[model samples]
Target: MTTKKILIVDDEAAIVAVLEELLTEEGYTIIKAYNGLEAISIFNKKQHIDLMIVDYCMPHLNGRRVIETMRQNPRYSTTPVIVITGSEKQFSNFPEDSTYQFLIEKPFNLERITETVHKLLG
Candidate 1:
């Protein structure tokens, strides 16, 4: 199978490290960003990205805002995104055209995320 590139955006270094290692082992290229600014910078440079896993609560910009900004660009408008949140609040009001618009609560499982990536990319 062709390799997929996944962007993991989170403020915490631990979360980014864990996801980078996990996705790398799954044979996917990982691009990591600590904040929304960094994420946008990478997105601007990289022309193609298969999927994005973003954390809800971040320092610079929240996951929701990041996703919203991403969708504004036609290039990434259809990109699949998985929002990770530790809060009990629900996420709604996102684009419906997306194929993989999912919200995975924090303390997420590796297997679950891997399955999600496979389903979205496949």
Candidate 2:
């Protein structure tokens, strides 16, 4: 099987670093972006991104906007996305029909995150 490419987006450097380390050990290629605009730019440049792990709050544009923009691209319309937010209530802001595959609250369990990734990508 081809290695899955996952984009890890978050304003917090620590979160990005930890996620990179974890997912890399799991054998997935990772692309990192510090904020939502950078995330969108990276998303445009990369092809076949198997998944995305995005923080809800971000600079330039929020995660919701980033995901909404990505959903416009037919190639990523159904791509699996994991939105990590500090508050579960933030999820309500997304449209009812949005395609975010998973919502992981802050202080998430690493094991659960890994399981979700495998379930979505597999």
Candidate 3:
């Protein structure tokens, strides 16, 4: 089977590197973006992203805006999005639609992250 493609959008390079290593080991192709604007640029250029994992607090555009823009595009409207946020209270503002899933609080366990990705991609 072909490997799945996943986009990691976070302002921190360390977080992106860690996630890249973890997901790469699990046989998924990883794309790294340091901010929401870069993420959107990559998405527009690549056009084959299967999933997106975004940090809620990022400079320029922010995760919510990124997902909202993606949802507006017919090509990405059905794509799965997983938001990683440092605040649980922020999740309350997320869309009620099933297309978006979330991981609350920062510093998530690698195993849980992998599991959530599997569940979403499955």
Task: Report every candidate's CA lDDT.
Answer: 0.83, 0.86, 0.83
Please tell me which model should have the higher TM-score, number 2 or number 3: 2
The digit string of per-residue lDDT tens for model 1 on 19-82 reads 9998899899998889988888877785588899988788878777788778878889889898
Give the winner by TM-score: 1 or 3: 3
Best-performing candidate as measured by lDDT = 2
lDDT string for model 3 (1-122, tens) is 87899999999899999999999999999988899899889767746888999888877787778888788788888888888877554466554446577654687888999999999898
lDDT computed for candidate 1: 0.83
Clashes of each: 0, 0, 0
lDDT of 2 by residue, 1-122 (tens): 78999999899999999999999999999999899888778768756788999888887888888889888888888888999888655366653335688888899899999999999988
Runs off by more than 4 Å, candidate 1: 90-100
Which pairs of residues collide in model 2? Answer: none
* Higher-scoring candidate on lDDT, 2 or 3: 2
Give the lDDT of residue 44 in candidate 1. 78
Worst 10 residues of 1 by lDDT: 91-100
Those runs of model 3 whose alpha carbons end farther than 4 Å from true positions after fitting are: 91-99
Scored by TM-score, the top model is 2
